[model samples]
Target: MLVNRDNPARSNMLAHMGSLQQAAYTRPIEYQEGRSHGLRGIEVKNGPLRFMSMADRALDIAQIEYRGENLTFLSKPGLNGRNQFDTNGAEAQRSIMGGLFFTCGFENICAPYVTPEGSKYPAGSYPMHGRIRTTPAEHVGSDAYWNEDGQYVLEVSGEMREAELFGENMVLRRRISSVYGTSTITVEDEVTNESFREEPLMWMYHCNFGWPLLDEGAEVVIPSRKATPRDETTAADATPWNEIGAPVDNKPESVYLHDLAADANGRSFAAVVNRRLGLGVVIEFDAADFPYFMEWKSMGSGDYVVGLEPSNSSVHGRGWHERRGDLHTIAPQATERKVVTFAVIEGDAAIDALVARRDALLAA
Candidate 1:
């Protein structure tokens, strides 16, 4: 139970409160004005962890917070409706609603590049980070229920289709859920290939942290065997990449690939924590499934954010993967599943626990 939020006895908690919203719940909401006007979503509150699950934007998350401290970065695009932008080419970035959990792919990832000609898909120019983020969802719904373990669960789910007349036919079924009295969130997704032919599939969980929670001297801890800078600029001063300083006037975006350590279950974790703020975020995933972990640090003015990206492929674009002959593709009618868990670490004790766990993983 959540102390002031809930009682020790589930019977007493239910006896006092008529609705679940008093402690943990998901409420439907619609944007009234601005760029987000007409957009529909649901507010999820599971103890100290809360966020808006955008129903129209492929069920991506925005406005993530724990204990009222903002954790995710919201770009100038704001929480605009999915209809506000094009899903292909470089145009996707113009109206990109870059909230916390931005999903990239089904087609391409990283930079925009020309894809090689497939049997059906001709040689074409793919957009930066692909077209999935702006794609609206269908069959969106939210609800709360009690599990067998006696924990209350709140969830928002929907499906998004990335398709064209003669293009790759992929559908993403996503379920984002959390339990009562917990500061953790889980995102489970199933990407199905509906096309008759095997289709290209590159996916990423662009989980971003920024601002007050990511101030000067914040640290990103990862149990990795090696870390490689994305470019020459990043390699120049890569020694201090783990400790992020204050934002600069014109600092360029630098990314690092960390070959993470995994347990027997193939699970790996990476965290960004600030002791001064008593706040932190841990992004955990299966290393065997999503083999590439990109530590993205963009300290540019007004664009400061750190992304703990867990992806199935590298930061290299689709063209690079094609050239390397390791472009991953899924068989027709097959499904690719991914489950990511995010936990908010609070207080010195919690931070210390995280460090100990990370260290154990490193030693293992």
Candidate 2:
């Protein structure tokens, strides 16, 4: 379970607590203020770790914290209600709220670009990262209980669909699950092509870390064989690609495409740790499913954060992806599944252990 603390069992913990909320639980909520009004959400807490997912935004993780420390970066853009979430004038890049675990792509990803005329996709601007985040979820549900394994389990599941007449139709079913007293939460997603025609798919999980969890000395531990800087300037800069830089004024973000290494089971772990803080965040997933990984280091004064993105394809425009002959597609009615686990590893020992895994991966 990779939980924070281990008790005799769930029964032992349950006996002391008057209610599940005292230790672990899941609750449905609604944002009632400003642009967030009317947006539905579900939050889950297990021990020192707690996170909330937006039911109105493809159920993406909107917040995460540990021991009252903000583990995710939140922008000035208050949570925009359903209708207010438009990418006009680069709103997402300028002011996105739950950037904590922002999801990109149902049809498009990366920078806003226009598909060529007479292309398979309608020739027009794809807008920033598609419409999945603004789409509301349906059939939302939450479950909290002690399982037969004697472990308290928390789950929130929902379905989100993005469709347009004479265009692509994709349905995403997501479930966020965690165990009581554990520091980890797993996100399971299944995306299906509901349209009759084959559709190009570009998916990426944008997991961001904020100031407390991310600092000047914090280092990212990933199993990358090498790195490819996204642009000439980044490539020209001799600063090591994997190193984290201190936040500075007008420090333009640097993006890198990493070539990852995985285990026999295709599982890989990427972590950001600040030994000084004795805190770290570990992300585990199947690299075989997500072949491409991008590191977004934005140490700007206001939006200081590091984004660990696991993607199915390159963030280069859809037309570029197609031209490269690497654009993945789902056959009509085909479904694909992706699972990622985010865990909190605190203390020197835990952080060291997690770093050792990356060391071993690099060696392998």
Candidate 3:
């Protein structure tokens, strides 16, 4: 067993080499067929990552630390330490802070969807949606979330199987039905533990898309006449919280409520244009589902991409509702569902097609 294939001292080297070659390309053993052995029991600590791709399926990216469990590449790093942006440096930092960059379809991190009241939630208490964690029983580190079901699913496309993130698992199961007009996938994930004592938690999608795939020439086209001013209570450009507030530099997680007083209706659409590449993508959400849309820009040196985020809550937290006298609460065992969709376009023609659709909807 310890012999090398080309060991000069071994008389059987030639024979062993031939055997190794045969083993390399021979059909896989029967046991390896169609088994969901999928990706179980593999430990990753750092560096090298395993990417699993199946025909006509979503790419399953597994980045494991050499000696540890898998890590979720969602969630943005805080603007503290290395993650913080230097005010005078490259504006891209504004976009990159908080580990939010990736080439995935888009990252969806939810829970306590937006900010809590200043006095109640505080910076220390802001509930971030995604985290690399481990359960006491398995001690295997993975992302955890409340009311999560129908989140990951193994699907068959052509000759491949993909892991997809479909919405709610029960009666309301939803998914990214189609992408780029060519592929369809469904993801399912369900977890139940007694310790998850529930409360009204925050939830929001943390999607990152970029590159020659999404580039600097890319821009966001939201169907809003005005953006709610960034809440000054916590942001650098904190200002009064109102519908008709000034045009402030937008930041991620900043609260943006519908400004009905503006010409456009609360129900607006947003699109991202990668003009140089002649590609565009549009995201549409109803104010009824996500009442706010945030345009997060990283003004410091970093990658240039736009965040067209739609949220159910304001960045000021439920407390803002209290201040405005609009706070609402959900009791135990209560579940709320939100849905958003993205469609890809090919070039200026595609952008015009989307714009035409938007105009038609508005006209109707």
Winning candidate number (lDDT)? 1
> Candidate 3 lDDT (Cα, whole model)?
0.33
Candidate 3 stretches with Cα past 4 Å from truth are 1-124, 127-198, 213-216, 231-268, 322-328, 360-364
Arranged by lDDT with the best first, the candidates are: 1, 2, 3
Off by over 4 Å in 1: 1-8, 116-121
Give the TM-score of each candidate: 0.93, 0.93, 0.46
lDDT of each: 0.83, 0.81, 0.33
When summed lDDT is taken over every stretch of 10 residues in candidate 1, the lowest stretch is 1-10
Task: Give the clashing residue pairs of candidate 1, or none.
Answer: none
* Residue 21 error, candidate 1, Å: 1.4
Give the alpha carbon lDDT tens digit for every residue of 1-364 in model 3.
1333443422342356654222111111111223222213221111122222211111122121111221122223222211223221233233222222111111113222334346342222222232211000122222111112312212211111111233111111222222111212222221221122223333343334333334444454555445655655325544322111222244333434334221245455566565566655455555665555555543222332334555555545544554675443333345455545444456688777766765565555
* Model 2 CA RMSD to the hidden true structure, in angstroms: 3.2
The reply for model 2, stretches above 4 Å from the true place, is: 1-8, 85-89
